[model samples]
Target: MLRTRIITALILAPIVIGILIYAPKPLMGLFFLLCATACLLETLSFMLPAFENRLAGKHVDTIVTKASGETHTKIFAPETRRPMLITVGLAWCMFLLMIFGGAEGAFGSLVAGILATIMVGCFLADDVQLGAARSISMVFSLAYSVLPWVAVWQIYLMAPHSRYILLVVIIVWCGDTGGYFGGRMLGGKVFGDRKLAPKISPKKTWEGAVCGLLLSIVV
Candidate 1:
């Protein structure tokens, strides 16, 4: 997995760097918009199944009995298409607003409007718990997948634009790469098997996190 990640990054780095360096502002914005859309879709896809399970009051794996009296565990498949499409469409609309309507008052107003719509819809749903779950999931997806790219787009519009973007990219890449390698190499050496978040990410050690932070700072 690490080797594949390295190889993929090597292949894509030049293309991404070239785009950042030479592409026009609109093209850059469009590129990031596509990225944001993909991220939003992925976020929704991941969370939708969890939301469905929560609404159904089922665990990640639920045991079901067949007519023949055989019991088997079933994993819920995400019913993500409708929600993903709608959320991605809204994300695109938000990007367009940023482009034409400007990223100041208009962007804020649109986000507010979206959130208000979500709240109203949730309020009117027959299942209040399900509606609440959907509201939380969608809000998180939008914030996580869309907001950072919007910030990056805004940064790209600043003076020394591409340079700023490149700096951000490099720092993030260095941190990620450093963390992976550091964790693999020296995970248990520094902290005596201490983990950063054992429940959430068992392999993530304090040592690796520190190394990544140091690498980011140096880079």
Candidate 2:
């Protein structure tokens, strides 16, 4: 797994650097937008596996309209993929709209509006199959994966010529590397023998976290 991660990083680093340093603002924003969409899909799938399934067919039986034109249903398979796609689509639409709607001065408001749109989408997608828990997870995961990228874009727009963006990226990568190596080397030692969140992530350790922090500071 570590080797795979390293390889992936090696392959992506140059492309990401090129984009961050040389690409135009619109291109950079678009690249991160695509990444955010992929992250949203992956996070939703992790929370609800059915979300990743291809849309085989839309079963009309899933919803039935009555004479009063009211749709009613008691139990039905979740329209996971469709609803998730729609929700994500709505979020991105709002994101783009905000980006073009006075980004020069209202960056924070634009981000808030985009995030609000995503939250609304999550609530609207809540249903029997896509329970509230899963819906909330989707919202959190989207925020987790997308917000940092948005911040990077914001920094770029705010400081187009500054190398601080590159510095931040380097620090993040250094921290990740330090944590991985530190955990492997020190996590099982009697002196520092413990996991950080054993129930959630058996491989994480306080030692690793400290190493990460130190490395980030040094970088």
Candidate 3:
């Protein structure tokens, strides 16, 4: 899998870079939309694996694709894929509409919609803790997918000629890359659920974070 991933990256990275540099808007939109769609769908699948399962009811396992007696737990199963694709499509359509509507309208609507969706997800969760976790996941999902998207779009729109975009990117990029490798190599780690707060940031360690921070500075 790693080998395939590397080969695919090697093959496509230059073409993608070319598109980012030369094609700009069209490529960015296409890539962002694809990424957004895939990520959202994967998340929904992971979050709600029984999306198709419950609907199948008593005959759930008997509903096989072909000769098989059992339903395949494929990632891109027909039932799961359709909803995700549809949701992302509608979201992107709204995003495009917002683009024509003005920045305040666009960003405001985007963020609002995201927050509202997360809130809804939170409400649907089992309890307060689950709701909070779902909310956090949704928020992080939006930020991870949307922030870079907004930044890239804005960079193309606002600073087409400015060299400073690369400068800022390089600094952050170098820092992140350096921090990742440094932490893995240098940071002393304890295995299992060693708790610091045992309440907040429980999974985190004092060691790895410090190493990452120092590595970022050095880089």
Candidate 4:
């Protein structure tokens, strides 16, 4: 896994640097927008099933008799594609608003509008409970996957331009690398096998987190 990560980084680093330094601002923004969309979709794909499971519990896996007298297991298969399409379309609209709206108030209003839309959608859905679950999952996925890229785009528009963006990216990369290596090498020794976030990330240790922070600061 480490070797794969290193090789992938080595291959993509130069291409990423080239784009960061030489690409036009609008082009870079668009690239990051696509990235954010992809990330959001991937996040939703991974999270929706888990969210449904939690919301439906044992009912999700219950067997039922159909009209044709066949037994079939009922699964919590929500409308995944439609929700994904709606979320992605709304995300694009948000990006466009960010680009042209300028005023922070306008952006805030747009966010409010989106939330209202989500609520309306929940009410209109055939299954209100499942719809609420899906809506919450979409919101979390958007925040987790898209907000940082939006921040990155905003930073890129700042005075120092790409240098600041590159600095942020390098710091993150260094931190991740440091955490991986530190955890592998000295995780249990310093922290007595304590985990940083055992529920969310079982492999992470306090020692690894400390090393990552130090590496980021140094870099």
Candidate 5:
């Protein structure tokens, strides 16, 4: 499934990017908005897993101790989007856009709105009971959803040849590839008994991460 997702992302990125470069600003905006909405929808649904709800007496709240030693039980109440952080983020971002929605307002406001949205999402989802959910919904959502949309917007500003955006996708793909094949092939046993992340992803080794870093530098 991971391989399939990676492949799908790789294949569809170029198609979406091609449309962004070829289409008008309004159309390009529509394309990115769809992507952003899908990402946000998926990110928000992580908290209320179907199987998780069936489990009785399972408290999914994460406890965090602040620098001042005050404990905070952060409950990710994903019952609905009415009062959760996801809706809070969506409303805030749209509010920002609405605030700057005017004939005289520069196009920069839209870009700023997206960035601020991602920033707010990351901040609101600081403490999480599930590591996978936290990374995909909060951390990865911020970067993946916001940055790609930002890049497409940037391409609208520099149309006709938005190959630089393709470069970004290529760099990530190559780095991921290197991490997978290189680690399994060359990496013998760097992290003997130490687990990187047993809960979220048990197979991701330190060597794999280092290999990705090196591949990124090359890219």
Candidate 6:
């Protein structure tokens, strides 16, 4: 697993670096837009699996109640994936586009767009069992996994803050490396045999966390 992670990182590192260093503003914005879209989709898969299945065109079993107080079973067909992606993905893209266009009211327009999208999603949900979960996930996914990428893009556009953004990235990389190595070296041996949060992450250790914090500070 470790070897696979390293190999994957080696393959992706150059592509990420090249985009960060050489891509023009528009291309850079596009890169983050794609990243945010992928993250949003992945988050939805975990937070609202039913919604993901629906988007993938799977027929979902649902029950309906008629006015006569009788219930019937039904299989609801899925919607087109591409159209949904394009529709929802455009919200993030529009925000990036507005930043690139340097509009004075970009933030306001983005907020309005987000609100309108959320409202539409909530109103259109037909399955009561999954509707609230999916609707809440839609809003949370945008704020959690999507907006941070948009913030990074905004930071990159600022010539002065761009270097600081790179520094932050380097710091995070250093912390990750420190944590992995430190845990391997001192975790089970020197830091007592007990595991930190054994139910969650069996490999994490207090010593490793401290080492990561120190490395990040040094970076």
Query: Worst lDDT window (10 residues) for model 1?
Result: 70-79
**Residue range 1-219, candidate 2, lDDT tens digits:** 888998999999988788777888787768778877777665554544323222222232234456445433222235455545655775576457646664553466546645665555456543433444445555665566666666666666667642778888899999999899887787767346567897667779888888889999987
Residues 114-181 of candidate 1: C-alpha lDDT, one tens digit per residue = 78537743753457676676666677778889888888887887755498999999999989988988
lDDT of 4 at 60: 35
Ranking by TM-score: 4, 1, 6, 2, 5, 3
lDDT of each: 0.73, 0.63, 0.52, 0.73, 0.53, 0.64
lDDT tens digits by residue: candidate 5, 1-219 = 568868997899778667645777566566666666665555445433321233322344434466445333344444323223554365336433533353234355545554555454445443443322332344444454554565455554553555665566677877887788766755647766454565656677667777887898898
Q: Which lDDT value does model 5 have at 86?
A: 54
| Number of backbone collisions per candidate | 0, 0, 0, 0, 0, 0
Report how far residue 5 has shifted in candidate 1, in Å: 5.3
Over 137-195, each residue of candidate 4 has an lDDT whose tens digit, in order, gives 77777778877777777788774449988999899998999999888899899879779
lDDT of 3: 0.52
Model 4: lDDT of residue 99: 60
- Cα RMSD to the true fold for all candidates: 5.8, 10.1, 8.4, 6.8, 10.3, 8.9
For candidate 6, write residues 1-219 as lDDT tens digits: 689769977998777666577777667777777787777665554444455355533344444456444322232224423323533565566566566656466677667656765665656566553445455556666677777776786678777425756776888878888888888778877668777787667679877887888999987
lDDT for 49 in candidate 4 is 51
- Per-candidate TM-score against the hidden true structure: 0.78, 0.66, 0.52, 0.78, 0.53, 0.71
Evaluate residue 17 in candidate 6 and report its C-alpha lDDT on the 0 to 100 scale.
66
Off by over 4 Å in 5: 1-17, 47-78, 84-148, 155-159, 193-195
Model 2 ranges off by over 4 Å? 1-10, 46-78, 102-142
